[model samples]
Target: MGTPLLVAEDISISFGGIRALKGVDLTVEEGQIVCLAGENGCGKSTLVKIVSGVYTPSTGTISIGGDSFNALKPRQAIAEGVQVIYQDLSLFDHLSVAENIAINRLIHDGSVLSNRAEVQRIAAEQLERIGIDLDLDAPVSELSVANKQIVAICRALSMDARILFMDEPTTALTTNEVKRLLAIVLDLKKRGMAVVFISHKLDEVFEIADKITIFRDGSKVGDFTASELDEVSLSFHMTGREIVYNRYHRTRTEDQPLLEVRELSRADNYEDISFTVRPGDILGLTGLLGAGRTEIALSLFGLNRPDSGTILIDGKTAAITNPWDALDYGIALLPEDRKTQGLFGQQSVKTNITSTMLDRLLTPMRMISGRKEDALATELVHSMNVNNKDISVLVDNLSGGNQQKVVLGKWIGTEPRILILDSPTVGIDIGSKSEIYAKIHDLAADGIGIIFISDEPEEIVANCNRVLVMHEGSMITSLEEEDLRADGIKERLAEIISDPDSFAGTNSGARVQGEQA
Candidate 1:
């Protein structure tokens, strides 16, 4: 560690008589990586906002490179080389990648003319500096979530930020992309830059952090060296409880399959995808990003129109050309990106949870009944185990885990026979993940066929009874019952996902016979 580049002391803030942060102290030294870890709404974000001048602290002193201030303005913080890459990335969607990256510098430099070449040069230089390549001419809106995160990082580097704060950077990233991003962060640290990485992922924190800080209920719990803590201790500090996740095993039922897709093919998206999801089975779809796992799920949910296929729900041909048709055939889809596709953030929890079945809450005269809405919302909240006492609270005010539960409740209101959960546990904390896993098991035990989709091998191995591997828009292989029960299953599944060709000739225990051409 080098000299301290940024320090905040006695930080506390309040909004509407609610203390968002309480007496938190943080220090980021030059050439050091510090991880700020806590459950959602634990004041980690509040402190970062304060240091970056997005929020003023109720009482605190901030020192940037030994220059002290009671509270810094946004421009003042920028002048002191502080840059924050918020989760939203804050990029101009309509602008090209090059323009989005260089626009900040051009504006800061007070350039009068639109120098397109200069913008391209600056963007290219920053991308090369980070050792990541991206299309300069591609519009920001056209990039994937991972690429957008890289753009955000490159933009931060363009500002020559001495210290960078990344909020939940890896939440949307795949495993490989996360590794690359961590490498970039380490590279930045080696170049004498400070990084404050806020994440719920303990593995990444242990892999990259020099120091780890824990926060709980708007107060600092403790700060410890990476060597001083493990995941168990970290979880204990963050949630005040020991986190435990039990491996799930499917309960055997009769031979009737609840949902089946024969040769489901979508041009340029997925091809020859065939699978059978039995009632009360949590069948997982696992592969790298863009491996057609989500594409197949989308088709099943009627979000994507498959060019050729037959969908059998309860052994009957279901022509699901649209989402309404899917719903009519007793199918419910919990979409991948919950924020954009699932819940109404600005609405009350009652409104979001009961949004799917509002017609069920009508009065005798066919008018919407507030009393019925409240009763159903209360029932769903209790059944879903959502962490909200009041149903009227805005969904945005709840934690990420709670918000996800609200989405699940909304979909569960439909009471479908088949539930498609696409990355259901993404960005959720460990405790909540366990809870959600239990809920999934419960749903399956209730005879609801679940099509669980995720890129994480451990989750797939733990929660799934049978697993199918996809590669390049095709169903590559399926892990049989014995394969799912073997030791090192997660590692073996990961290997197959990383490279499916390696197991083609070998008796790898996985059912290569199930591989699709």
Candidate 2:
């Protein structure tokens, strides 16, 4: 390892009376990947903001490339080759890839002239530097999430960034996409650039980190070499407690099915999908990217229309052609991308919690009843264990886990018989994930059928009593009974997903459904 590229000592910051960061210290060496692990609101983002000059710390000293500054301005940080890629990526959606890569440099250099050839050359150079190939003329909106991430990296390199800070970079990527991106980060490290990574996913953290720094409750817990820490120990440091997860097993009280889909078909999306969610059953739906798991969820939620299918709720055929119709039929969907599709970030927590049941809170004058809304919000918040003392605070001000809880409260307020949670724990810390899993188990215990959709085998194995694997818009395998309850069920499901044919003839009661299977 080379000399430290950047260091911050005794970093402390506050927002009003809240101490966002307290006595946190961080050091990043050249060619090193330092992963910051913590629960949401544990000072990781605040530290990043302090380092990148977004927020001036109340006390600290930042030393970058042997130059010390008590406080750095945003432009000064950029001049020192510090670049941060936020979760959003913050690219121009309408601009071409080449323009998006070169525009920041052009603006920084105060260039007013249009030079298409120059922009393409610069973009090509950055892409070549990172060993990536992207269509220069393709608009940013047209790229996949993984491709957009690569573009963001290239753009950062175009600014001559010596140190890169990435926040939750793989929250939306598939396993394959995450592997590819990690490979690129390794290559960058090989070229002697420093990377500061922040993520809630521990497997990725252990895979890519040379050093691990953990924080909890606005304080730095400790920093250790990656070789000295494992997932359990790291999670303990992050949450200040041991995190234990038990596999969920359902105890059913009713034999009647809560939801049943027969011959559900949507061209280019999903086909011949058949499954049943019984009362108290947490059925898992999983597959790789574009495997139609989410497409199936959307169809059930009435966001996507199917060509031919029969949806039976409580043994009666129901026509759910829209979201309202689906809600009326006692179906609620917790969408995959909670930040975009689920919560209203700009709205207050109270409003977000009571959003789905506003009709029940209206008064005789047809105006919203504040008293009723407050009562319902209080009930849901307490039930969901949301950690906000003020319900009037904007949902955006809460942490990712809390925001997710609010979204859950919103959907639960509808009192649905069937709930579909699509990637509900993505980008959430281990502590928060455990709480959410317990809540899911409790809801199932209350006789609400759950259709859990995720790409991670461990999550599926831990939470579901039955699982359906999809591939290429087709149901490939069905695992139930002892197959789901076995000791190595997680590994078995992973193997099946990677190569379904290998398990096709096994005597484990696994059924191969589609032509691909």
Give all TM-scores, in the order shown: 0.95, 0.95
Write candidate 1's Cα lDDT for 1-517 as tens digits. 4799998999999999999998899988999999999888888888888998989898989999999999988888988999999988999999999998898888888998869999999999999998888999999999988899989988888888999999989877777778888999999999999999998778999999999989999999998999999888999999999887667777857669989888888899987778888878889888888888888888887889899989998888999888989899889999998889998889999999999997899988998899999999999999889887699999998888999999998998899989999999888877788789989988888888899998888888888888888777877678765677777777777777766666443331236322221
In terms of lDDT, the best-performing candidate is: 2
Taking every candidate in turn, the Cα RMSD to the unseen true structure, in Å, is: 2.9, 3.0
Q: Which stretches of candidate 2 lie over 4 Å from their true place?
A: 495-517
Superposed Cα deviation of residue 198, candidate 1 (Å) = 1.5
Residue 440 in candidate 1, Cα distance off native in Å: 0.9
- Per-residue CA lDDT of model 2 for 21-140, tens digit only, reads 998899999999999999999999999988899999999899999999988888889888899999999999999999999998898888998599989998999999988899999999
